[model samples]
Target: MAITSANQLELLQTAEAVAREKMIDPGLVVEAMEESLARAAKSRYGAEMDIRVSIDRKTGRATFTRVRTVVEEDELENYQAEMTVEQAKQYLSEPKVGDVYTEEVPPVELGRIAAQSAKQVILQKVREAERDRQYEEFKDRAGTIINAVVKREEYGNLIVDVGAGEAILRRNDKIGRESYRPGDRIRCYIKDVRREVRGPQIFLSRTAPEFMSALFKMEVPEIYEGIIEIKAVARDPGSRAKIAVISYDNSIDPVGACVGMRGSRVQAVVNELQGEKIDIIPWNEDLPTFLVNALQPAEVTKVVLDEDAERIEVVVPEEQLSLAIGRRGQNVRLASQLTRLDIDIMTEEEESKRRQAEFEERTKLFMDTLDLDEFFAQLLVAEGFTNLEEVAYVDQDELLVIDGVDEDTAGELQARARDHLEALNKAALDRARELGAEESLISFPGLSPQMIEALAKDGVKTLEDFATCADWELAGGWTTMNGERVKDDGILEPFDMSLEEAQNLVMTARVALGWVDPDELARAEAEAAEGDAAAQEAEA
Candidate 1:
């Protein structure tokens, strides 16, 4: 509609009111109004004309203009938007070919349909501005706690009224047994903030381990002050959780600070968590020590760690096995997560039986392979000789150091060990050749003789097989005999290779076999050609 002087003032006031209500700048609202008016004006004026509208921020007075650019006579294409330089000079004293000129056009009296269209445009702009405002307000608030009142429920998700915004708490993010009614005030962690077509969506979570850590930060002054640091946290939301904390100040006990006086600090956190039991443990750099603390209230008899496998074997008293494992293995599971290690729990009885079995197996292996009697085999086993490889590789002096073994006896043992290894290698090579193992694979720089034999046994007898083998397979793969995925000790049959060594061997095989991507090879050739060309040009 036509804007009278009174209506202009009313428009400015309306724009300001909407801007304040929507938490957006007043200038943005006025700009939206200008665009809406311009869109409506296009209907009255011909749509082919370059039309623009501007609203005075203070006065709310609207101005419409028809825009045209000066161009050379030959360059003039659209008469509506471009004019000849000679024609442009008629409007100005001196006109350049690139200069723009605007002529004031009377504001159109918006008809019923045009007014409705303009109103929709303005509302859409306001909605968009509100979404942008919300996104900017909440994006940085992710990973922090926020207090909100439950506004509504849709399906299982709770819509909560956060300050100046609304957020959704999905069912999966809520504590298992917790329920909320409308208008219930609750605290939750801001898990995510996403900008969508509808608006900015703020996602809240009460089940995240970080939520528990945040609550501890809020309740424990030491953590907030940075005297005590929360190292890691593992949670079974609404059931049980464990937190590892360390103290920067030597005198301050991190666990004690978290526990608070008379258990007040921890109790505050526990109450917030819907009574989820929390175990506060002091963190140690030593993994085994930290694991012992993580499996609290369960006495650990010994901890055997396999660093390469990132696993820990925890042996406890027979009576303490259930305690260490917890009800349904929750205790060990949480400890594993907290320590970032795979944990296997066993009782003293089980460990003892395993040790005895291993001892007997080794005794038999030495007797059968080395042709040693039971007495000599037991003596070698007691001296920590586990296998033929160690016996063959150790210095002759090492053998002499064993009790009841003289220099002559050590010499005979060493000769037998060497001879046995040589005969084994000869047999393995013969078998590998029969299996069609490629000469290139056998002679590859890093593939040990034993590794070549292992490859043959595992059906990796060709260069392509060596190239295509996955890193895990090359590194001996997992131990699957027990119906569980367990780490191998890198002893793949006749060879023991480290993961790094295995990776290098695999890469070498790939390069030798030209199994790498053709595109990468092409790129490398192109790079080399360019480098050579540059060098020749420099010399010339």
Candidate 2:
């Protein structure tokens, strides 16, 4: 029962307590120390020496055994004296130079080595266990907001202690007009949790799009409940941002709700972000409306959309041009991003100049390139004939009867009129189709594809065709399939037309035929009917 002093007992007890605190296995620590002591003893006592150490944990006592290998001859100085066959038999039945015979050694060497080895093993295990624990602690906390204190500045970024880990908040995440000092407390959204060689690494941001979004979720019940949706966000982080919001409930005003009363809701978010300005704009599908809203504080008079160019020409009053364009063009620049358009801002004066240039170009074409002779051109010009359609679609007979023309001239004018009139009429019909007039008319039963195609091809493309076809058989005995007679009332519905509508369409057709006075066609038809009635009255 050789018991060591109290100092030796204290050392061993401290080692055990440290192993427990650092979560290191006490058995592993003991095994590592034992291996180190055995190696140290062999080095000090010679390679052929065998040393065994035993520990008395309760009494803190340690003992060592020493042995020497038996040899056939004295090949090395440290080897035991060459044992004769009789000597080897007395010591061991079978002993070789590579094998050993043992005896108890002193406790001093084992005690000194065991204590040093245990200290080294415990320190290494503790470091590794701390690292593992930190990684596990931070891994579960990713994507959560955390409060942190600024520790120091490194490479223009803030090193913050976020409870279980150290986080880096980059410079760009700081508000433009706001800053932080060491020891300041701040709230940040956790962006990432990563493992590093030293410890758990966390990344934080205060300017991420989701930071504002998360704040809104905390402040607004609708956002948390998913009643409002943030469709898009264009942020000049730390200064201003445009958030396009939409409501899932039509009855709700998304922008108003996000803005809150007196802007308390959005203001809360802005305060968290250090008074960064936020604009909550309602999302609109209409490009013009959306662009107008995207450029806030700047009123737009008109937006000329050039979709093919992927640009819009915005006209603002002379005074508003600078405001709309913003300082350094930032207002329009952000608006362009928000609406996804290339905006060209123009003041009223510039726009007026553009319109004047266009007007002059068109005037030159009409005056110089148009086929009308100087005298007739001047007459048409005086009559406000800025476009050829004015003359081409006019009533040819009416123009021929305009006091100065004879029968031959009238015939020639009529021929020219017909050519131009048909061209203009065909162009108008093409435009109407483009404008969706054809789809609107397609549902009428009598206006079947075959009939419509026939009329379109025959140049009977107006409701005037109804008048011409009044005597023409539309179906069996002039009765269409709907049992409607080929009278005006009967055929109007098929074409989705009324009598007045039919008359107007005929007038348009007549004008396109170079008949300037469509009213005369109606008069001629009425006179023809009156003469027929008079002839019938005489016969009766």
Candidate 3:
């Protein structure tokens, strides 16, 4: 390609056209063209030679030059890429190291192959620029709805023609029972914009909960204006969905606004989802009240919340059990997701039976372990003392408040509880010793007799084994034999150690066994001292 002045103008015009068509900056197109021309020039000038090209932005004038840097004789690694100060004097008056020189060269005639290579280079550059532009445009637009046309389908995934780019709607992200054909207009949530080697892949989703929330935001002006807020959403996808909304303005009902006039707003969303049933319920701060609303259309007779377990036991009338549970437990499952709590739906009869069983179990435990009569065990169980731990920990004053339990009786009961625990600990220690537990592990600070026995049972019988134990392993992060993690139901076995206590025990064992360097121990002591000083200062 000869760069005549007229042809130079054509080159600039071509760049401008391609930039406008590709939605990229014209300067980027010019840079690509320059790079392509430089690549072509290298073929004529020899690949080892330093060649550079530039095109004037205003004048459209093209220039090609060979670049060389002046260097000491010893520094001239490549003769074509560098020139010695002695050789530099041939081209310039001053000869110095670290100086650059440029010599203009006449433009070369392009061979057919060279021209094609240059064309490929410019196309690749322009394609890269376009991908980057699309990525920048859509990356921040994730979680928002975008309208597109179905351009084609591949492997059950739709290629959507979003303006200036193409997006992918995977089969799994499509609403159940929804179908699309080529050129079909569709709206999808922009799930992600990923930049890959091929191009930016914009993923779209129709069944995402965020998609439903966004639809409501579009339909409800109050939500858009922040007068109403969507607290949570749970979906069975295409079949049914529930959304909890709260209102900031006292006069505005959030659910009513989301439902719109005679359910027009929600119906629009439902139509878009192919008739998915939607339940719009008002959000409540009280968990029990919120659970009742979540289990809507089902009457809840009572709710027993186990806060530590993050579970709720909902007792319903016999007739409402199936309704509360829904078909195949869908109602309670969605309610759990919406409220972020596990919901156990039960009939009143089941709850009554469970309560009675629990009462009997606690009574038997007290009667057997505390050596109490059946009546006394029942009395303690009735007073809400579920376990010996509670009996041992409760204040004497609180125990005295129980019916028929004077201060002397409360004291005697606590002593007996302590005695039982001590006997159990002594037995555990004996068992641990029999299992080859080291005296060092038994005497380790922060290790209780029960912990020692647990460790011995698990084959962690030595001081080194105790030192090597991770805090989570020593505390409560173990998965059960059934492959389930020890959850809030309770800590298991050796994992019953508190994190702080476990750390202390591990560090003490490590130091006692010489597993840690003395310098590290000193540093740890200094850090602990500093931490304690800072804490004392904060308290002050």
Would you list the C-alpha lDDT of every candidate in the order shown? Answer: 0.87, 0.66, 0.88
Model 2 residue pairs with clashes:
393-511, 393-512, 394-514, 394-515, 394-516, 395-514, 395-515, 395-516, 396-514, 396-515
Using Cα atoms with residue i matched to residue i, what is each candidate's TM-score against the true structure? 0.89, 0.49, 0.86
- Provide the clash count, candidate 1: 0
In candidate 3, the residue pairs with backbone N, CA or C atoms under 3 Å apart (3 or more residues apart, or in different chains) clash, namely none
Order of quality (TM-score):
1, 3, 2
- Model 3 lDDT tens row, 359-433: 999999999998989998998888888878789988888788777889889989999999998998999999999
Ranking by lDDT: 3, 1, 2
**Taking the tens digit of each residue's C-alpha lDDT, what string does model 1 give over 479-525?**
65553457654435235465777777777677667777657866987
The model with the greater TM-score, 1 or 2, is 1
Q: Give the alpha carbon lDDT tens digit for every residue of 403-476 in model 2.
A: 46566765665456556656655675565454434442333333544345445554444544433543222321
Instruction: Give the clashing residue pairs of candidate 1, or none.
Output: none
Candidate 1 TM-score to native: 0.89
lDDT of 3: 0.88
**Backbone clash pairs in model 3 (N, Cα, C under 3 Å; residues 3+ apart or in different chains), count:** 0
Candidate 2: residue 284 Cα off by (Å)? 1.7
